[model samples]
Target: MYKVDKDLLAIQEARIHIEGAKEAAIELRNFTQEELDVVVNKMAIAIKPHLEELAKQAVEETHYGLCQDKLLKNRFACEYLPQQLANQRYVGVIKENYEQKTVEIGVPIGVIVAMIPATSPVSTTIHNAFIAIKSGNPIIFSPHPRAQKTIQRTVKLLKEAAIVAGLPEDGINYMQLVSSTSTNELMNHEETALTLVTGIPKLLPKLKAANKPFIYGGSGNGPVFIERTCNIQQAIHDIIESRTFDNGIVSAAEQSIVLDGPIVEQAKSELTRQGAHFLSEEEAMKLVNVLMKKNGDLNPESVGCSACELAKKAGIQVLPTTKIFIYEQAYVSENNPFAQELFSPILALFVEPNWQEACEKCIELLMEGAKSHTLVIHSNDEHVIREFSIKKPVARVLVNTPSTLGGMGATTNLFPSMTLGSTSLGIVQASDNISPEHLVRIRKVGYGVRTLNDCFNESGNQSLHSKDTQESIEVILRKIINEMKE
Candidate 1:
């Protein structure tokens, strides 16, 4: 037998999986909402008992994020996700406007090619599977090479549970032969209707080239603004908690702190009291060197590391109790790594004269990298909060809460999702946190309420040829001529 190249093997595997998924998707479309919910609920229940075990597996394999936080993410995906999607309609006749004599029907988007990231592999896998099934679509996941085993294990368990619950075996599949060629094949497959991506920025061009509609979960350079009217203690605590959670691997976590000049000292004091170390200018430069690669991308080695570990890597001495490393900066720019999304337990601190200047700083920081992802504002004044909400370029403006938790819907009312969509200034289809509804297309049924004559009559165009209108037009023309002659 002739030896086949690994890339060719991967492509063949992708084609096989896509074909299977296409068949499964057709079968899934026949399932009722209740039946689909039953399967999804069973899958969630099956994974509920293995949350901690899977979290440990993910941490061991990927070496990113804390196992404890991963467990919380797993629970959020398995338990909270199902609850949030339980009563929601994603099938036929989802909405009806009786007054307008129209109905909205939901149809699945077909086989979804989902790309899983290494940062939150297991939880993202669970969330993607649940949403796809809930929307009556079959999904094939291309796991990150670093976290392939963990993601494969997650998909295996979910597939087993789904099969036991009467779903097709191919309804949830993961690529066994993982490679770029395989990923591209999966995306370009004729059966593939959409691609759901939650990974690095490099794969975007490839996804675009596949000529398929894609929903991307881009990065965030989230900035938290501490307005003067905010409670200094609570604001500082929220920032620390969010930045340190999961070692700041969460994209929605605050990367920069814009503090009002009036409360700058108080905020720093609170941050210091809460185990944050403010880095000197020299130390900050050291971190910048290690945090980013020569090409301006985040270094994988520094990502998801604790502040103490980062300080050690940068050769800066700090207490073991340090939970966050802060870099006080005078400006925001591409040259400032602190202003960009570090994806670690480090934050840039900026002091502004007022809320207006602070808002401008936040915008600048976001524009540098993380626009349209998320922004946090801690303020007790409704007026200030409202102002930030309107002026910020971020899709989700979290107020008075941790941006990580708030953006993911753990602390706020936003939709619960592992894959956040950056729709405003970023390259995603939807701006809100993704849900099952995003996986389905709405087919609107309309009944004609008015005739063409009615539209023309309503616009008052029928009377344009009347004698009064002609006289008015002639009078206006004569008036213009008289003025010109004068």
Candidate 2:
């Protein structure tokens, strides 16, 4: 009876927010591109000084990830994201391709539902809110139960700044009263445009049941392949750095390392030198159970731990300087926790004869682990690199860079984003790093380039074709310009 009352209260809260958000979305449609960018910029500036504080608070509240690393993530959202977003237009008429006799207008997708992950609460919230407002969409955030205080604090901070900078009063919000029922209410709400879930794969069924479009940033157990011809020391360095960043909480981080057969020993030596502690057979088995729950899934409790911390939990002794916990893995299966996403500074090592067999092994690991997300290759050989790129089912294929930094656009050319959209994981929505452009629909305007004579002509006739009608495109364009001026 008590639970029912709380659920009802939560539902009420969701409905209120959704209603206000719908109104806000309507108001936002009248905002020009510059107006939306101003609100986003103001919010980003207001949140800039508190980035470190929020990172600390997030770490303190969730007990996940290193505080310093989380700070870097927050800075990435503040620093890199804004520079990229500033020049890009996401509101009103965004493009006019005069040559194609077409124009593209950016239309807001309406109210959005954002599910902030406990693992990346602050960074993901900032990203979701920034992009949402940038695209002129009102957004309601649902904080993860574990990181409620951190996420709520972030949303509160951004909302205040956004409104002060001319955003609608109810344009941005977060659910202080969170429950499964309440979250479901938001997802299923008639006003909810789409649900953007970051690092929470469990909600897919509920999101699907809602019958609304959703973008998901789910699991990643992508393999980082080090070819025989690659620089052994540099490859090992990239892998260790990637897997240990934020204690491996980032989904794009390397979870497995696939090595070509001839250079296996040398690469292993290099990895050890670079602080990856290889576990013995007995030690590996002991840690397997610790990393797995009773249902044979990756244990959530073991996620986002440093190498030393993960080692301690598994009752294995290791030097404090250890940067990664390494386990030599042969087979890929559900029962093998090494084959799964440990989500900590732990990696499964695989040895294959060549790039062809290595590619096969990577596919097996991807299937057994994260379904499909990201893959990395370290090699100077363009042929091998091209082959890996062509064959992988993952969304992003990073080359010659650390997977975490490269995948997130810090070291690569990907759009700066926290939401690494999992393509082929079910949704056909966004298969790249999500940005403001993904939050809105493109309204294309194409002028008529042909008449009924040209269209219905069964016989090949140039006179009845678009060549004669090509002159009309300029007239149509001038009329469109006149309409815009009016």
Candidate 3:
């Protein structure tokens, strides 16, 4: 039997609070672009200090992730995100042309349920909450259980900021404890107008089953392919950075590397120089088999583990100072579990004698995790990059830069997001990164005439039979007359 936690009760209460807030939000049909800007900018400014504080509290309480990395993520959520959405109006009316008298209006979607992950607890919490508020929707967030303390503290900070910013009270609410049942309850709630779910694939169907509109992001298989024509040193460094950042827990993190030609050796040497320790062939195979369990599911225990942690799992007393461990395999086979996503600092290397084999292996790896992900290639050649981007079905094709940062929209100009969408199998949209614009729907109004004669003059006259239009009109009329006579 399962007992309901008080935290769950608090979440239910928040849901009730959001019920009224949703109505108030929908009442705010239109806002000027300036007003929208003020709301967004103020939210960003208000949350900036709060985000930093929450990031610190998260690291302190969770005892996971580096404080610096958390700070960077916090900056991304508060700074970059607002900058992107600034001046974008989701309010009442938009005038297309005053002379033409066209007006487009914005309609709020009411309350939303945002389910966030533990790995990106604070950043996502702030991002989702503010976006929802800006769009005139009240939000209730359910954080991953492992990072509940961080989520609770962040929500408190955000609420204080919102109030200071002159937003409604209880505009943002959250769950301090999380569980599968609690998530299911939130998703299944009848009052939830929309859902923004970013996590594993298993929960997507449940959100769908809730029969509520949703935006669910899929997993990322994220593969890095190295061509012989590219710069080996840069490619090696980029791959290492992508595969090891934040211990490779990111969905955009590179899961495997496909290297071809003489550059294979060069890439290996560079990777070794960057603190990647090559495992013996026997040790590599052993780790691969153990990590990928027989049922084809990723072993949560081994995912996102450090090199030393992995070595310990193998009963090897490796030095704790090891930065990254590389596992080299001659061939990929069913018995080999290297095809699975190992979230840790383990890099699976497939060295090919030629580029063709490397590209083929890259495609094969994507198929293994097809619809829920992204793939990456590091090539300076425009032709090779274009070809890979065109052919690969993955949502995002990260090039030259590190997949972790580039694919996540941090260093790149793309939208910074923790969610990667896959379009191949309807797992998610084809968008490489998701944003607040995705959650909105706009109603366009057409206006020109107020009277029947005015309507005819403005619209009906446009398609009338003037001399130039007579030829086509006669042809159609003749065809119809002939058909009637027959």
TM for every model, in the order presented, reads 0.91, 0.92, 0.83
1-486 per-residue lDDT for model 3 (tens digits):
989686667556655655755664654444444554565577677678676677777766655555667788788888888877776666566446778777876666767888877667888787787677667666788777767888877777777766675556656777655667667777767777777876656777786577767776656666788887787888888777777776677667787788877786678878878778888877776676556667877666675566777777876655566668777777665445665666677777888777567777777778774543777777777887887877776677877888878876886888767665665544232355766555556688887556543333445444454664566567878998999999
- For model 2, residues 84-152, the per-residue Cα lDDT tens digits are 999789888899988879999999999999999999999999999999999999999999999999999
> Number of clashing pairs, model 1?
0
Model 1 gets an lDDT of 0.87
Show where candidate 2 strays beyond 4 Å: 1-4, 454-486
Number of colliding residue pairs in each model: 0, 0, 8
User: Which candidate has the top score in TM-score?
Assistant: 2
Name the better of 1 and 2 by lDDT: 2
Kindly indicate the candidate among 1 and 3 with the higher lDDT. Answer: 1
What lDDT tens digits, residue by residue, belong to model 1 across residues 1-486? 988799999999999999999899889989999999999999998988889999999989988989999999899999898889989899888989999999999999999999999999988999999999999999999999999999999999999999999998889999999998898888888888888988566788787677678888868888889999888898889999999899999888898999999988888899999999999988888988789888977789887888888888889999989999988888877776677677899888899999889989888877775456888999888988898888877778999999989988999998999988875433356777888889999999999997654543555555656786667668878998999999
